[model samples]
Target chain A: MSTEQQTIDPLTPVLSADWGEKRSWTRAVYETGGGYDALRRALRDMTPEQVLTEVKESGLRGRGGAGFPTGMKWGFIPQENPNPKYLVVNADESEPGTCKDTPLMMASPHLLVEGVILAAYAINAHHAFIYVRGEILHVVRRLQQAVAEAYEAGYLGADILGSGYDLEIVVHAGAGAYICGEETALLDSLEGRRGQPRLRPPFPAVAGLYASPTVINNVESIASVPGIVRHGAEWFASMGTEKSKGYVLYSLSGHVREPGQFEAPLGITLRELIDMAGGIREGHELKFWTPGGSSTPILTAEHLDVPLDYEAVGAAGSMLGTRALQVFDETTSVVRAVLRWTEFYKHESCGKCTPCREGTWWLVQTLKRLEAGQGEEGDIEKLVDLCDNILGRSFCALGDGATSPITSAIQHFREEFEAGMHTPAWELFPYRASTVFAPEVTPA
Target chain B: MTQQSTGTPPISAEVRAELVEIGARYPQARSGLLPMLHLVQSVQGRVTAEGIEACAEVLGLSTAEVSGVATFYTMYKRRPVGDYHVGVCTNTLCAVMGGDEIFERLKDHLDVGNDETTEHVDGLKDITLEHVECNAACDYAPVVMVNWEFMDHQTPESAVQLVDDLRQGNEVRSTRGPRICTFRQAERVLAGFPDGLADEGPSAGIPSLNGLQLAQLNGWGPPPGRAGSDADRAEAVADQGRAAAQATAEDGQEGAVATEASPAGTKHEDAPGTGGEAK
Candidate 1:
């Protein structure tokens, strides 16, 4: 893995370092590779406060959608609260474009296991839960095994290596609900209720699980902690831009030559990552891509040079949400993509808030009309108006997300929408040509 | 057990014990309702009315509540599922990359619509075909999941062939995991029971490491992290802190293992290293 010393290597495979190793998820392979050393150092040497300080200093943002700073979130737990604290790792990664956490937990389950232990210790929580999505049975199996292995290894459970801290990790699986990815809905689902969002401000740190102080974090965010603790805060902060520190898994999929999880310093541009991925497949020009996952507004080829860090992406008018960059070429229809996403949001909406539930269904209907070339002249304006009503009006981000692709696609590809109105989307951009399975057709 | 059951429960004694065990694993008890529902499905295909009663009884909740929870999630089906449940990714990226085509082909071949199960033919295991949303496996776009095991990089032809193989009861394996198990058996694993298949297949797949493969091919590595003495400073501070703790407390090695070095542990210049433990 050594590179020329003169070059700042574009790829930094920290979380993914051992992903390719034989039997990487096993305790035998994991311990041999220093898997629990961070736990050793935390429990043996530093105080819990000190461990918390190192993380706060690292400036690690939540790898989940919102990008909230992890340490600050940990700090929010009221230490003096009488109720027992909890740490829940949100493993329900069902975002349309997000796949980083799945691969992370699949290949290196121990990383998340160790992170759970360390994070529990940092918050003084004796009990932690990993609420994984139930759809991926293998991931649940891998996690269950890893947790058992950690228990056997004494990295988890009471008094690890003679340290006087006790913790227990539970692997809970959620029934299929994308809304559970939303933190409060996750909390609700974890509580064995219908997964739905709750009103905020008693923010989880103040009162969560069973109405106690709690710390909920993403799988990647917690997994990154071992790296920060092993290598100093500066080591983590050294990688990315000032605001968005440390390395992240940039998932490059769709229309790319080699789509996969690219772990790099946060500020790396999509242009460079795409170049590293061997550029768009067969040199088809990049038409539009999601800077983050499907939730964040889509970016075009014009924004390829924008750094993928949170601040830069926000400055470029999109959040660095889960870093799920789904690329597409000109042969793809912007309208069709937006409609598929819209249908997804509608299907998965939890029906919690009125705007999201009703608005998404209506949006799907209107987009279907538009895509089928049966739209009225003012339908484009109506679509934007629907997006405006749905944005920020729902209980959670699902409604807001349903609006992103619609509003953004309209902004960038209005001509495509307008010109293609007399023609169906299948005629405007042949679905066959858009997909790789079909034979290649040269761009106009 | 105060009047938890209204009538004789229809599930087996062992299944009831598993349901109770799932409930006992949670601190709140009700939190185990989801997994209990899964266990119920594993035993009796779909969330049966009696299954809801059992879960409600186990968690001390009303059957109405349990039914509400079951109906809310997509996985908890009202209808009985086939022995094998095949899901094709039909979200945007996967759809654009031919998931739509694959799904259409499967529907035609299986003679079933979305979320519908094929009829048993001469004792063949029923196959339920559903077009699933983005399963977060878009890197291998147009991915399919048989009993929730990833079948990556699938084309329409391959998807049809896969369903056919499943119907024929041929031994099929996950693209990244073990031999394909029945949907009910898979649900047992989802209910937090190990199928002893953890070590069956490769932990990671090709698409999971495309960038790493290219980086290794190009001899690229991470930049020198935390330049100018972070390595030394952090260690010195840690050593100082350890010494201070050692001075106050009697240090006892409760569980000690022989220390040896592993290749994955060795730190490389200008790059992050994997964990090194006392093996």
Candidate 2:
């Protein structure tokens, strides 16, 4: 095991450094490990502009799939805006393969709390909100407890650390909605409205969170700030490739010996991560994997060594979205996998726009037929046609993302989908006969 | 709030106070809508019409608007739910890892299908089962969530037994944290109240801490040749320098503190008291 570990490169642990410690979530443990030291440095030493400059120099891109520059995002807030500004942390991590944020908050909420303070200070916001998913009550409790500790310890509240900067942090819980992960949709949900994407001429930076200039950042992005501020910008910039700087929390789940969040520098390949994860479950060979989340196009074993950075992944015909690396072995059926992802998109399509709402529904019907081996001739072409219509025509990325697996599976595994067309899914993989489509079987 | 025949009465004084408190946290009262819906679900087992009406009254919105928001979110059930809501995550990853089998097993064991409720199964009453989308705990694939708390790495046999335990009224606890509470108790916690059990046990599991442990055991620090040879040393020096500057800044701002001091407790004034420890 140790020999296999040495095969993978030794990567730095940034956001995940303190995650393993006992009681890492507590304020005492966090502070003892230099938790809020960065916030103190930013508040006492650097001006807001300097802090902004440091982040920009760090070249840290958003970890929430978009890959937008984090510093540039903070800089988008108009400094001279008369209305009060807000900073909203997007903790509603609902992407199919994404699981980093929940664990981060559950294990170390103070890291995020300290980062929120620094981010609010850098962006000159008085109020910050962490909109977490409501289903994870334990995480919400941990965050609320961490916030309460921050207040009692003077990390939050008026005159934080006696720096004369007053900032309030609210830990808000989001009821279940995948669409809310989208920034504009998240803002709408935060404002107590349906979680649907809004028109984006005036983005969230200009008009968000009750018509205030709000900077909505992903939890990983914000949590990365404290380390950047604590260590110099050059320190962060030193890691990763030239363009995509710093480490990211790469969530590896499914069909792996050790499935969890691996905090590696950007541009590491799936081959390396898989090695670190003790390779695929014993005896199974890698068949296919999602480079990011299910939203990103699926990559086969052929693309194992492809660098997982935004530009590289884009060049490879997928986005580096949320770093949700879901691995599947040869035993897994591609058609069944695509069908499950499509069903998720169908269920979560928010019904906001014509293309996503209507397109996802139709796509699911076709995929369901394909998976059940009832697909007629021309079903594959029909699937592609549906994807083409929804890709760019949808109101939001949800529609486009819903098409990723369908289109990508056909690209890589057309034979699997075709095999299912004639033979029932259970027949193709007899092992799943008792489970996959068993619910639809009527009782005698 | 208008009275209704939805079985639940108009919002109680305690619920009204909680709603008002949640509303104050947001700049716009209506922004408190989701938490208010959670509050309603906490008391009514689901978002009843009466609960929606009370939320509308508190947020100064119409019942139609409140209902729309409540219906939009999957967590806000429109009808009464079972005491335990067993949500099997049949997302792509979990489904491939026996989630489908587990879902089928639970349906058979509880005699319920997706989003359907069964009455008086064994000793359990109103056990609602749903094939939930990804619950975001895919690391523990084949995951089942009861009352929104994780039951990680479940097999068909284990999942069936889980429902049986609940049906038999056994003290079923989550893989993490204290003993699993009822669905309503979980709802109240989701509604922004802490159950005070969050501190009882380890919040994370072995899977969660796997990466950090591996990194340490392998002697893997930051990526090489960047961020200085020693990331810890650089951060320590920076911390000490900043700590010195902070001390000087605090000493200099002694008089300014008086002028800049906003009212105490104003920061979290709008935060909910559901957990009672938030304050």
Candidate 3:
């Protein structure tokens, strides 16, 4: 199951270049390190269409899971439309295993701020909003400070950098709904409604943010823009595979000895990343991992050499989503891991649509039973059947994603689930105690 | 507006003014619902009936609508909460790294389950414990957050000590930020207003900067394949290692000087967005 080490090229640190610098989040540090240079060049030298074309040529896909083309998403906004368009940066990094955006904002808030302005200019947006998750108060404060700094520096507000372009950036916070991470749901939340996903065909690009055409991009997707614009299309396109060009923040968390955000070109393999991460935690051996967050299907050590690009991961039956490589060692139980992820999905599932709202609730109950060794003989098939019903039938990707762990865990480790039917998870991993099942005691 | 509740008084004029300012941030006033709820939570311990009515009136929505939105999000507490809302992330990564054990121990120690507030006992009565989802700081696994500020890399012993300090009314501070505030103070900051403590602490931690540091130590580059010959790369790496070692030495010296200068460190300031001035 061991992957042969390949000669990985020296890592390309693009978005994360300034992350290690002292006081990196401050505007002074950012400006001194050549921040806002791209925004100036794009506004002064290039036309909006030219800026859009360069992004398209650069092949920067959406860093927020979906792998949608960044330029294409902006281009989807109709030029002929007289109504004003809005740009919303999805800073709600709530996916279970995804932790890159929060750190990115914490370390370099100005990078995201600068990127938002460039993105706004490209799409002819006068007002941009950064919808951050409410749970991270520190990050929210950092972003607010960054926006205020941008406004004070004339990078935001009317006629930025003496260019005719004007933009206003608002750093809005979401209460605590994971569904709001879904783009349309985010728009709905931004509009001050119940954070639920809207039906498509309007697709956000056509009608969004107060019924006006809007472009929604992830924090990383927008934050990666200043570099793309500053370095030119060919420069960004030169790295990574053809379809998935440019460097991305690969968040390597969990069992790895060094768990952090690794910014590398798109096509790098997990084997190379593991080597850079000081390999798996000392005595542990890699058992299973997720190429993306928990939403993507789990891949075992057998697939370690798979290039962590969109196409390669997709071909291998998972996605290169957000590149949240959550590695687990042999001591980890597949059933227990899936149950924890399922609990998260169940808790965070917005009761918007039936398949997700109802399906996720049922999944959690079934998973709890299976994990506690109270399942019947047909329970494994029942789990698969339940996943099958919810996979494509849900209103949004949440339901589909909720099924990924169950079906994939079963696909790769059916024996584990079968064993779960006989033995409780606590017996298998004695150290993995949880409060969820602890007996309730009266207060003394 | 819907019938006002007589039990709880209306939000203060300052809170109302702040709500109005927050409402104006959005093109539609309704968009300010979440932040307005946060403001309410900051004022009251949780989203009270009066708070819901105020939010509904501010946004011209029904009380039911406001309540629905408030209760939909986990951050907004429906019941009374402890002064410090301790949320230990028990998600997959953190759980495996003893977050589950930490949570179990805390539950037993406090005699309160998830989402339950402890009975008022001396100074610690306002403690609410919950197993929160990933706080997005998984690199420091088994993370515990007090009032939404990160308490990174927690073990059972450290986590127990944190709760003990909190309960004993000792000055408890976050690992990477200023002294930990009450949950209400943290909520105030979340409501689109800066607490002016933005410059208090290190923005990124060593674990956060680990990958980038490794890259620098290895002489990683922007261009993928053009990292020079092996001998040249090795020399660059050696140079980087020496520079890093020197920087660490200087930092150690500066750290001692800083400790001497600020023996007690700065105290936490309670500056809510009372003025509601738009930044």
Candidate 4:
């Protein structure tokens, strides 16, 4: 390792390093800051096998909620399958409190564009699709313009940069369906079908998108590719922990003083990130927070110093899924937060699986009763029972994620939920105090 | 988010041609169904039966199949939408952070329930108000979306004021920049068409660049001596590509921190005890 690699900064902004630069999204600014240099190098110097080997050596894990090894995922595409391989960048960043990708796409879409070219090259795929959610109109605009610019610059399309490597990137926009964020469902949605999860014996790598070998990586995961290409696997591997290599954007939101994206190396503690975020909105202490997005179970103040990597968070009863650290103070009620999240899960649950579709509704019903102080004697048990049925029985992670907040909240704050049997959540914690925007007092 | 249809409107020739164009972009014709449906919504203001039939005819899919796809996604409205679609984010994080209060205040101010439209009295602001799920803007919580543009960090008072400004035809802009447009125009953009306004706003807003700004402030960057930052910077300046298309991340306004980002629903931090937004 280089002597300089020993110095680790608390906040390492690689992907986000150019976010503050003026017009960083354009190919001009991006190239000025060494953008497509990775793509140019990849296409000119490396073979598909070589690129694959480099990625696998880097040990970069998926930035999407699932912590799968990204290069290993690229390696899974059966090259001899004869069917054309495909790469899909999942830019559908709709997870609650996970605001990293949308901003990344807005600020530096060429990062994702360059990564797409590099990934498509690595997997020997000519076609790539970036399925951005429809809600963010301007983000879609920035990405579309970036793709067009890449084509003009010869980084995309046939014969890229004097190399005979051919690639096509279609910036597909998704209709507002949280379920479509699921890889299988996103494939179905891409094919103009109802966005339901396909059964996974033939996973996406085997049979995805028109029944071909497809590699689907998250926006952040795919965007991190160019850096790996430009600087080699060892350089990419140098920043993060042993197993979980490289930097991640920790989206600290919800009651934090400076709620935003903190791109730090893997295994950085939430305690350090919170201090960088001006220490939990000034006065309030961290009551509970999610080490990742809302789907991975919530962590209490006890988990403040837990190293936020895949293995560390898993040992601490959570997964480093998306690194969306949603900080909640004591003014927020656990029961109320769990109920609202349960409502989201119920709303988003696709009806393909009976357990998730039916179970989420029942869990919400029980939680609502508890939140309103109208619970039955066994409502908490009933909520857990419903969660148990949905957890493993669902077709996808949607149903599974619905149970995380409810079960974790009950496990940590049983007293507050039990108090919900006779007293309302509003009585214990007034909702208004949790926000700075109180309605102006109207003169009667 | 269910929309009740009034009457089925047939798809126009132009819209049919555009649907066919969208269909051709995909390897499989049916794969273009989502964007085509979005295009139909842009034209008809909702996914009418005729719009579905047009899409089916273009892609050789059955009307039932197209309808199934249409109804599955929340964005494909079944009924007519207003000139603007005002969505209040009532998701978990946003809800506790005053989204519930904002949604309620807008509902009360406009005399509309969730997923309902305001009465078009003399064409002030005809709005379809709905409590939407998260739009991935939780950092700027209590986010209200006007047609898909983010009006971030909204309070009940500001949300109410925003609706009033819209009602009176004041030119309201997204917190990130970009003038507000009809939701139909937004759908058109989402259907793989650009409005040439990608250059309208700040690339990264506060909180988005919060970490980067803080790191720069503290002189923190990509580690002290990691991979080739020095070499890469030199190479970038040497071989910059496509000098013609110059677009800065910021146009006029930089993405500086707007508010101090204290919890909403309180007047001031130094106030004695927590201030109330008592109903």
Cα shift from native, residue A132, model 2 (Å): 0.5
All candidates: TM-score: 0.91, 0.89, 0.89, 0.92
Clashing pairs in 1: A33-B275, A33-B276, A34-B275, A34-B276, A34-B277
Top candidate on TM-score is: 4
Off by over 4 Å in 2: A1-9, A431-444, B1-10, B121-126, B223-279
lDDT of 4 by residue, B183-233 (tens): 777888898988888877766788797887676555554532223472244
Scored by CA lDDT, what does every candidate get? 0.83, 0.80, 0.80, 0.82
List, for all models, the DockQ compared with the true complex: 0.33, 0.26, 0.30, 0.34
Off by over 4 Å in 4: A1-5, A438-444, B1-10, B224-227, B230-251, B254-279
List candidate 3 segments past 4 Å from native. A1-9, A432-444, B1-10, B224-279
Model 1 lDDT, residue A70, Cα: 94
Candidate 2 versus the native: TM-score?
0.89
Q: Between 3 and 4, whose DockQ is larger?
A: 4
Docking quality (DockQ) of candidate 3: 0.30
Instruction: DockQ for candidate 2, please give it.
Output: 0.26
- For model 4 chain A, the run of ten residues with the poorest summed lDDT: A435-444
